[model samples]
Target: MKTLIFKTASGYLLPLLVLFSVFILLRGHYLPGGGFVGGLIASIAFVIHSFANGLEETKHLIKMHPGFLMPVGLLLAILAGASPLFIGETFMTGLWFENPVPVIGMVGSALFFDLGVYLVVIGVTLTIIFTISETL
Candidate 1:
């Protein structure tokens, strides 16, 4: 497959899409968006990149195999949800801590879950785009 490099339009649009995805992900906890929606949006960005560039270029952009990351993300998410169980609490219970320092206090399993979702979304998004593009 021929490798296509990023052009000016893609360069500008990619960052915008990624920023939007992050915004959605962050606001998801309270608003209509969430990790899933954010992931989808981010995946769309990659898809756009794949369309603008070629499959080989996209492959080159990925430093590691996306499949490997998926399990890690899943584990993090599971561990997050299961953390409360270890402490004799119910599943998916919220845990909060007071910080001696700034507003950054040790948060509960929810943040971990979000992190897991973030990684999973990124991994899956990359994998889907790479796979489909390669087949073309």
Candidate 2:
């Protein structure tokens, strides 16, 4: 299964998939794609690479344990949701910045929440997949 062509193709596909996933995540607020789908796409990239290059190589490429991302993402999401409380607003309230970012448009708690979801999804998914792969 580890054909040279497959390895090379997977190598190229990993970056492309990750980039596309980010694109999907960023456009999610106004479009169909979002954190969950984006994370799935990104995880699929790593899975494909692992299939071609082996688990160790894929793990090495990622540079860190996927499980670590979970808490960080949770913290981000919680912070985003709780931020409104400081301003005398309800929890999980949507708060928008005065100035919109050039490309992503209006930045807000929702975006941060979505980003948190993105990281959480990626972490959870990769953790599960890698665990299953390891046992096989």
- Segments of candidate 1 deviating more than 4 angstroms: 1-6, 99-107
Model 1, poorest ten-residue lDDT window? 99-108
- Residue lDDT tens for model 1, 4-33: 344556667778998898877766655687
Task: Give the Cα lDDT of each candidate.
Answer: 0.73, 0.93
* Candidate 1 Cα deviation (angstroms), residue 8: 2.2
RMSD of 2: 1.0
Per-residue CA lDDT of model 2 for 17-122, tens digit only, reads: 9999999999987789888889899999999999999999999999999999899989998999999999999999999999999988998998898899899999
Clashes of each: 1, 0
RMSD of each: 3.6, 1.0
TM-score of 1: 0.79
Candidate 2 residue spans exceeding 4 A from truth: none
Task: Candidate 1: give the clashing pairs.
Answer: 28-33
